[model samples]
Target: MQIVVFGLNHNTAPVEIRERLFFAESQAPHLLKTLRDRGIRESAVLSTCNRTEVYFCTDNADSSLAAIKEVLEKHFDVDRRILEGYTYTFRDESSYKHLFLVASGLDSMVVGEPQILGQVKDAYRMAVHSNTTGYLLNKLFHKTFNVAKRVRSETRIGYNPVSISSMAIELSKRIFGELHNRKVLVIGAGEMSETALKHLKKEGLSNIFIINRTFGNAKKLAEDIAGIPYPFESMSDLLGQVDMVLASTGAEKPLIEAGLVLQIMKRRKNRPLFIVDIAMPRDVDPSVNNIENVYLYDIDDLKDLSQKHLSDRLKESELALGIIDGEVAAFSSWLRQSEKNPLIAYVIDKAEAIRVKEFRKASQKLKNADEETIRNIEALTKAIVNKLVHPHVTLIKQDSDREISETIKRLFTPDEEDEKDLDNRNEGQ
Candidate 1:
C-alpha cells in the first residue's frame, strides 16, 4: 500500500477557507470511519487551527485522495474545486516526510512552536482510539514521535518563544526576572490582549488587571482567564499599581501618552514600568519610550524580535531537517523491505512462536517463579530470539539472489496451518 496525505495548510489556504473545512475532535472518528467504509482502512485525520490534513495508507492513491475530498465535500459542505485549489497531496516518502516536518514543529506558522507536536500526538491518539490505524499507521506514528523527540533534543528549534504573546511574556520575564506575584495591567479586552494575558498567566503572576472600552467585555475576559476586571476609566489608576502594562486596543489614537505614563511613573517615585503596545494605531505614544523608567515597545519592535527568533529557529531547523531526512530514508527502506519480503515476516513469526513455546515450557518447570523472575525470563528469551534471528534476516534482506531466498524460505518454512495463518496476518495488515 502507498502512504498518502491530502489536505490544506495555513501556507496553502487562508483562515476563512481553512475554518470552513476544520474538523473538531468529535468529528475525526466519523471521518476515519467514513474513509474506512470507502475502502481506506488505515487512516488518520489531523485538524488544527493552522491546517487540516488526512493521512492514509491506500493501495490506490488517486482514488483514496478523491474519497477524502468527497468526504470533505459532503461532511463539511465545501466544494471539491475549492479543495483542489487550496489543497496539497503527497504520496509515499514525501507524505511521511511532510508528517515528520509537521510533528517536529518545522512546518508550523510560527516556526519552532511546540503546540503542534502535542496536536499531532492528539490526532494520532484519536486515530488509534477510532480503530482506524493499522500496522503501517501505528508504526508510522510511533516513529514520528521518536523523530520529534530527537529533533527536540538535538536542535534548539523550539528553544525560544516566537509568537507575539510568547514574546510579551519573555519581555516581562526579562524585566521582572520572576513574574511570580507581579501585577500586570492588560489594557484591552480584545483578542490580542486576551492572547498575551493568557501567556502571562502561565508565569504565575499574582494578578492581571484587564480594562476595556466596554466594562462587560473586560469582566467577561477576566472571568474566562481568572483575571481582575476594571472599568476603562480606571486605566491611569491601574497603571500606577501594576508592574507591567500590555496595551492592544482598536482605538484611533495613542491611548497611553507620554504625559500619562510620566505622571504615573513620578507618583511611584520613577519605579520601573514596562509597556507593550501591540495596537495598530499605537496604543502607547512613541514618545513614551523616551520617558525615564518607562520602557515601551510597539508592535514593530516585538515583530523585529520575533523575526530574529524565527531566523534563529530557521538556522536550527537545518539541523532538524537533516535528522528528519535520515529518519525518512531509514523508515522508507524498512517499509520497502517489510512489504516486499514475505520471507522476513515468516521468519519473524516462526522465531516468535518458537520463543513463546520454549518460554512457556521453561515457565512450567519453574512453578514458583515470581512476576519479576517471569519478566526476566521473558526478556532473556526475547533477546536470545532476536540475536539468533538477526543474522538470517540481515542476510535475506541484503541478498537479492533467488537461491538465497529459496534456501531461507525452506529452512524456516511453517506447517500448512501456520503458513495460512501467517498469510492471513500479512493480508490483514
Candidate 2:
C-alpha cells in the first residue's frame, strides 16, 4: 500500500476556509470510519488551527485523493475549484516525510512549537483506537514520534517555549502598548491558558481573572498566577471588567457569543476589549468581532508573531531540519529493507539448498577425508555460494524499483517443467 496525505494548511488556505474544514477530536473517528468505508485501508485526520490533513494508506494514491477531494468539497461546502487550488497531495515516501515534519514541528505555523507534537500524538492514538490503522501506519507514527522526540532532545527546538500562548501575549501587548496593569481574563485554565497566564504574570500583569468550567482548576490556576478565580457562570460579568480575554477552552461550541459580547460592551461603555481565542475549535464566536470596540483573534491569527519568533530561531530550526532529514533517510532505508525481505530470503534459501546438496555429495565421494578437510571444503563451497548471491543482495538493498527485485527472483526460481525435461533427456541418453 502507498502512503498518502491530502490536505490544506494556513499557507494554502485562509482561516475562513480552514474553520469550515476543522475537525474536532470527537469528529476524527467518524471521519476515519467514513474514509475506510470508502475503501481507504487506513486513515487519520489531524485538524488543528494551522492545518487539516488526512493521512491514509491506499493502493492507488491518485484515486484516493480524488475521492477525498469529493468528500472535502461536500463536507465543508467548499467550491470544487477553490478546493482543488488550495489542497495539496503528497504520495508514497513524501507522505511519510510530511507527517514526520509535522510531528517535528517543522511544518507548523509556529516552527518548533511543542503543542503540535501532542496534537500529532493525539491524532495517531485516535486513529489506532478507531481501528483505522494497521502495521504500516502504526510504524509510521512511532517512527515519527521518535524523530520528534529526538529533534526536541538533541536540538534546541523547544528550548524557549515560544508557543501560541506566547504569541497571543505579544499580540495583546502590541494592541495595549503595555501589560503591567492591563486587566486580563483567562478562560479554561488548561495548559494553553496556563501558558498565557505564565507569560502575563511574568510581564507583571497583576489584575487577572481566571474562569473555567471546573472551579478547582480555575482556583488552582488563579492561585499560581496570583489572580482571582471566578466560576464559569461569571464569564459575562468578568468580560466587562477585563481589557483582554484569552480563551483556550475545550468547548465544542463557541462560548463567548456575539450577544454576550454586545451586552458586555454596553456595560463597559464601549471600552475596547481584545480577545484571543487559542482553542482548536475556537472558544469565541467569530461574529463577536462585529461588535463595536471588540477585537477577536483566533489561533490562526497568531501566525505573524509566531513567524517573528521562528525567524529569531532560524539557526536552531536549520539544525532541526537536518535532524529530520537524517531520520527520514533512516526510515527510508528500513522501508527498503522491509520490502525486499521476501526476495532476499528466497535467494538465500535457494543458495543454501544447493550448497548443502553439493557438500553432501562431495563428502560421500571422499570417504577417507578427515573432518578438518571436510570443514575446509565446506568453507570453500560456502564462499562460492556467497559470491554467487552477493549481487542479488546488493540489488535487493538498493532504492531501485520492485520490478528489479522481481526479475532477480524469477532468475533464481528454477523452471520445474524444464528441469523434468532435462531429467528425461538424460535418462534417454
Candidate 3:
C-alpha cells in the first residue's frame, strides 16, 4: 500500500468551500469507519478552520478518492463540482512530504503557527481510537508529530506573531507604543476574538471588553478572560470608549463605517484610535484607513509583520526540514527492508524441505548396505546439498540489505502459471 492525501486548504480554497467540505470533530469516527469500509485500509480526517484533509493508505488511490468524494457530497449535500476545482491529491513520497510540512506548520497561511501540530496530533488520536490506524499511518503520524516537536524546539518558527489575532495586537502596539493603560474593545466572542483577547491580555492590557450578538457567549468569554461583557446593541456606543478596537464580527457588510467613525471621532475631538479589522469582507470600512488620526489596519497590512518574523525564523525552518528529511529516509529504508523478509523466508524454507525429502529417499534405497555405509551415504548427501545451496541461501538471507532484492525475488519466484508455462515450453523443446 502507498500513502495518499486528498484535501484543500486556505491556500488553495476559500473558507466557504472549506467549510462545506469540513468534517466536524464529532463526525470523524464515523467518517473514518466509512472510509475503511470503502477499502481505505487506514485513514484519518483533519478538519481545521483553514483546511480539511483526508489521509489514507491504499493500493488504489483513485478508488479511495472517489469514495471520499462521494461520502463528502452525500454528507454535506454539496455539488461535487464546488470542491473538485480546489481539491488536490498527493501520493507516496509527495504525500509523506506534504504531511511533514503540514505538521511542521510550513503549510499554514501563517507559516510556523504551532496550533497545527496539536491539531494534527488530535486527528491522529481520533483515528487511533476509531481503529482506522494501521502500521503505516501510525508510523507516519508519530514521526510527523516528533518532527513538529523538534522543529518547534530547535527552530524559532513559532516565536513570532504570525496569527491574525497576534498580528492585530502587534499592529496595535506599533501604533500606540504599548498596550498597557489602553482600553481595547474586542467585538464578537468568536474563536478569533477570544484568541485576540488572549494575545492582548498577555501584553499587559487589563482593560478589555467583549461584545457579541449573543449575550451569554459574550458573558462567558468575558468571565473566562476576566474582562467586561457588553451587549451587541451597545457596540456603536462603546466604539468611542476604547483606544484600540479589534472587530471580527460575522456581519455581511461593514459594521463600523467611515461615517460612524467620523461621528465617534467628533465626540472625542479626533483622538487617535487604532482599529484592527480581522474579519473577512471586513467588519471595519476599508475607506476608514484614509481617515486622519484614525489608523485602520486590515489583514493585508499585517503581512509585513509576519514576513519580518518569518525571516528571523528562517534558519530554524531549515533545521526542521533537515530533521524531517532524515526521518523520511529512515522510514523508507525500514519499509523496503520489511518487504524482503517473507520472500527470503519462503525461498529458504522450500529449498530446505526439498533437500530433506531427497536425502530420505536416497537412504531408503540403500537398505541392503551396512549401517555405517548407510550413515556415511546420508552424511555425504547432506553435505553435498549444503555445499550446493550455501551461497544462494546466504544471498537470500541478506536480501534485506541488498538493493536488488525485489528483482531477485521476481526472477526466482515467478507466479504458478508462469512457472507452468516455462515447464511446458521446456517439454516441447
lDDT of each: 0.88, 0.81, 0.79
For candidate 2, the lDDT comes to 0.81
Which segments of candidate 1 are over 4 A away from where they belong?
213-217, 250-263, 266-271, 290-293, 342-429
- Per-model tally of clashing residue pairs: 0, 0, 0
**CA lDDT, candidate 1, residue 306:** 85
Order of the predicted models by TM-score, top scorer first: 1, 3, 2
lDDT of 2 at 79: 90
Model 2 residue 269 CA deviation in Å? 38
lDDT by residue (25-102, candidate 3, tens digit) is 999999889888887868999999989999998767788889999987887798888758898999887788889999
TM-score of each: 0.77, 0.52, 0.56
lDDT of 1 by residue, 1-429 (tens): 789999899999999999998989999999999989998978999999999999998877888888888988999998878899999999999999999999999999888889999999999989876778766787899899999999999999988878888888888778789999999888878888877777788889999999999899999999999999988998899899999998888999888888887899888788789999988988888998898878888899989988999999999999999999999999999998788976786687677667767887899999998989988999899899889988989998898798987777667765677657655656856
Task: Judge candidate 3 at residue 141 and give its lDDT.
Answer: 95
Span of ten consecutive residues with least summed lDDT in model 3: 344-353
Q: Which ten residues in a row have the lowest lDDT in candidate 2?
A: 420-429
lDDT score, candidate 3, position 136: 69
Superposed by TM-score, candidate 3 places the C-alpha of residue 45 at a distance from the truth, in angstroms, of 0.9
Query: How displaced is residue 49 in candidate 2, in Å?
Result: 1.0
Clashing pairs in 2: none
